[model samples]
Target chain A: MTRVRIDLFASLDGYASTTGGTSDNPMGEDWGRLTAAYAATRTFHERVLGDTSGTGTTGIDDSYVAAHFDGIGAEIMGAAMFGLHAFPDDPDWKGWWGDRPPFGTPVYVLTHTAPRPPIPMQGGTTFHFRNTAVEDVLAEATEAAGGLDVRVGGGVSTARAFLRAGLVDHLHVMIAPILLGRGTRLWDDLRGLDLTHKVTTEVAESGTIHVTFTR
Target chain B: MTRVRIDLFASLDGYASTTGGTSDNPMGEDWGRLTAAYAATRTFHERVLGDTSGTGTTGIDDSYVAAHFDGIGAEIMGAAMFGLHAFPDDPDWKGWWGDRPPFGTPVYVLTHTAPRPPIPMQGGTTFHFRNTAVEDVLAEATEAAGGLDVRVGGGVSTARAFLRAGLVDHLHVMIAPILLGRGTRLWDDLRGLDLTHKVTTEVAESGTIHVTFTR
Candidate 1:
């Protein structure tokens, strides 16, 4: 069975990112600080930052960062995560990840806008747009995963939708020791989620706690 | 300095207790399961349950349950917690703890109703009704604490008020592996809380994650 997974970095107050992120600053001022531990990892440096030097922390944080891409064959994300908000009117926006994005799998972007042609980038990454329900998209993504795991790359709202729908099999949330007064909350409307899932906790050296919920 | 602290058993979704609880069912349907670990502790059996047989688990969960009354001299809670909601029309109601309550300190009840005379119970527990601000009540409770630590006993709203007002010095939240779909949330409107405190995580044998925040 292709398991549906989600990995997100949240603050202690349960905010994934601050609100009012513009094209110039998609994550706002707190993004860098909130993801400081993640960005300092070897896998993040190599995959997200495109740093091939391999000079980064290789501790538990790096282990989690590396595990993110381990068995992920497909990904589902919200339109905002694909940088569609930055260029809603422009059709040439290929996301913030330059030409070769980190995800080397078929990425499904949930959006209400008209479906555009799939943008196939370097590596095996392909951006597919869909405005369908969470179940339908998960089915499509799971099929596209080809017996591998499907990763839910979220901007908070997408993951919450999937979680509320009871479709997520595993969720790894890294709670950074920071506070963003306001933004998108991951725990909203997720009451009684603990009943459905078994939770485990791991503390990282960066003072970040990794809370994993397995259904 | 007398540090004001709180210890709450919360669900994975951050709910302290379900709504519309009666005196017989103070925590609602899922309360027993949510507090099973704490209830099984010897300290809880002795203190809350009045079990003097000295039986119960004495592990990490027991350690936390035992620490709930370690340095506390005074306690603060909401009217709902004192069974005021169960007997709104009755003035002779004296909480659910029977004649000999477990608390060995002055407990302040925050309410807007008519002030009542202090009800002194055995074991040094006195229920004092206070229709005042969080700060004012904390001042009185701190004074009553006599240089010892004051506990912010909660029914969710009381703790939230104290936390939002920045009056709480330490918060120990036990995240039980159960979910209550509907209830009073403990983290509502509490954004940026991580910035003001240092968070630490500990996992108990019963799979409950003890999240402690120290200012």
Candidate 2:
């Protein structure tokens, strides 16, 4: 069976965004610090996004991002990531990714309100709206992936629902060195579940740590 | 002005707690790694709680807890921390701490619904309920601290309200080793804020990193 995974970058004080929908300064340099593992998979990122424009030094902590994308076949995200909440009527809030999203596979978005049809991007990525239980999206994602693994992209609430269902397998987290005094937190109701995982930690030059766990 | 700082220990995959309110696993060698930190702080912790007999480690992550409580004169949190959402009518929701909460100073809870009066803990920790803006609470907390700082302990939304007001001066976060695949995420709509900070990072023996950022 393919293991489902969730990979994310977060601050030391535990906020994903500080400004509701405008987390301008939440983690700041911490995210830059956390993506150190990017170097290991720089080519992959560039290949998927088709962006070959910059020459910045890869940070040390981006490895988790690189490593997690290794064999991801599909993605599942929350409506918030696609900016759906902001534009309830436009139906054009495909995603922040412009015409082509970074993922090169199918992406499913869990939502309460239904909107336009799936939008096709330049790459193979296709964004589909899912109006069902989290498990339904996961089932679709798993089947669409064939034997390949699925990546549960974030937007706090969506991820929580999945964890509550006991679906995630391997989780990789990148901790940045900054804090957003106030913002959305990651583990609001996680205390009830009995989660067990083994941690492997590595530090990057930018002062971020790449931590991974297996369920 | 007394600057306000926020610190938290959350799982790397973004969960502060499982659904049950217990912290998601810290993902190292159980409590074996933080024995020293626990021992060093155990006396103060027990004395504050009037529990002379609770000697051995509580088996909780002491370093994470210690780093959380290191420097602060006052603390502010939300009603969620009082455990009211899950246990509405129960008087036992005075918080995870029994007659003596860990915070040894005044702790203000920002809320609009719960109608409980302030309860003073053994260690001078007084829980005050205020249905006011976070900025007001911070102002009051700063004043109450004399010259010490006020810490904004949280539920995600409460923290975001403070960060949105630009009241936080420092944020310290601990990224643990697990992921709540879905729930409330830490970052949601935080974009485009100009923030600069200095980051210092180190890994504890428990595989959790001690990452701090001063803005």
Candidate 3:
């Protein structure tokens, strides 16, 4: 059975990002501070930043970051996460992740417009665009996963859509100690969600609380 | 110097209580489960439940619950919390708390109706109705506190108003492991609150996360 999981970094007030962040300033002004603990992890330094010098913290925060890529076989994300809004007119836009993206699995991008041909990158990552419902996309991603779990990469709205549709199996939210004040909220309209899932919390030494909701 | 503080018990999704909870249902259908950790504490059993026998948990949860009543001289709450909605037309409606209320100080209830004379209870709890701004209410509560801290008893909206007005100096939120999907949220419109206060989190053995925001 392939499981669907969502891993997101959010502020204590439930905001995933600050508003008005352009492609040039991708994660907004407070992004760096909001994700400081994660960025300081050894796994993030090696996987995302491509730092092979073994730099970064290696405690509980790194353990959580390392688990993010442990069993992920396929990934699904919204178009906004792929920086499509920055180059809506440019037909040659790939993504914010450089030519050699870190994801070594089949990544699906959900969009309204017709998808272009799949773009293959280094490290076995292939970007496939889909214009379909969340369930349909999940089915396609699950088939592509090859018995491994699928990850729901987010922009807040994308994750909420999947959650509202009751398709998420496991959700892990890392709440930083910062307050973005006004951005996209992850807990909106998610009333009565506790009835369906069991929630557990862990407080890290870095002041981040890891909340996991499992069905 | 007297500090203003807020203590609220909320679900993992930030809801303080579900909708349509009558005085009989007090905190809604899931209220008992939501507040199980707090209710299991010795402080709740004695202070709120009026249980004379020492019969409750006495660890971290009790420590946090005991702190709820420590060093508080005044309380400010909304009319809805006092069950005014249940007995709006009743001129003799005191509160849901019987003869000896838990609060042993002056409590200011913010409302839009005509001011009512102060009603003193058996345990030194006096209910004073006032139709005024958040600042004015805080001013009066501060004076009544007499160098002691003032507690902001909540129904979510009241606490949000005080937080929005930048009047709260300390805020403690107990994140229960339940989800009430459709109720008043405590995190709404509080985007950059982290910048103003320092946040610390403690995960209890009973799966409750105690988050405190102090300036």
The TM-score leader among the candidates is 3
The better candidate by DockQ, 1 or 2, is 1
For model 1, the stretches where C-alpha displacement exceeds 4 angstroms are A179-181, B22-24
Quality class of the docking in candidate 1, CAPRI style: acceptable
Candidate 3: Cα lDDT at B204: 92
Model 2 lDDT, full chain set = 0.65
Q: lDDT scores for all predictions? A: 0.83, 0.65, 0.85
Give the CA lDDT, 0 to 100, for residue A152 in model 3. 93
Residues B82-116, model 1: lDDT tens digits: 86487766778998778887788899988777498
**Model 1 C-alpha lDDT per residue in residues A143-190, reported as the tens digit of each score:** 999999999999788998999899989989887766566777778777
Docking class of 3: medium
TM-score of chain A of each: 0.95, 0.82, 0.96
Rank list by TM-score = 3, 1, 2
Estimate how well candidate 2 is docked, as a DockQ score. 0.14
TM-score of each: 0.90, 0.54, 0.92
Q: Please give the DockQ score of every candidate, comma-separated.
A: 0.42, 0.14, 0.59
Q: After superposition, how far is residue B126 of candidate 2 from its true place, in Å?
A: 27
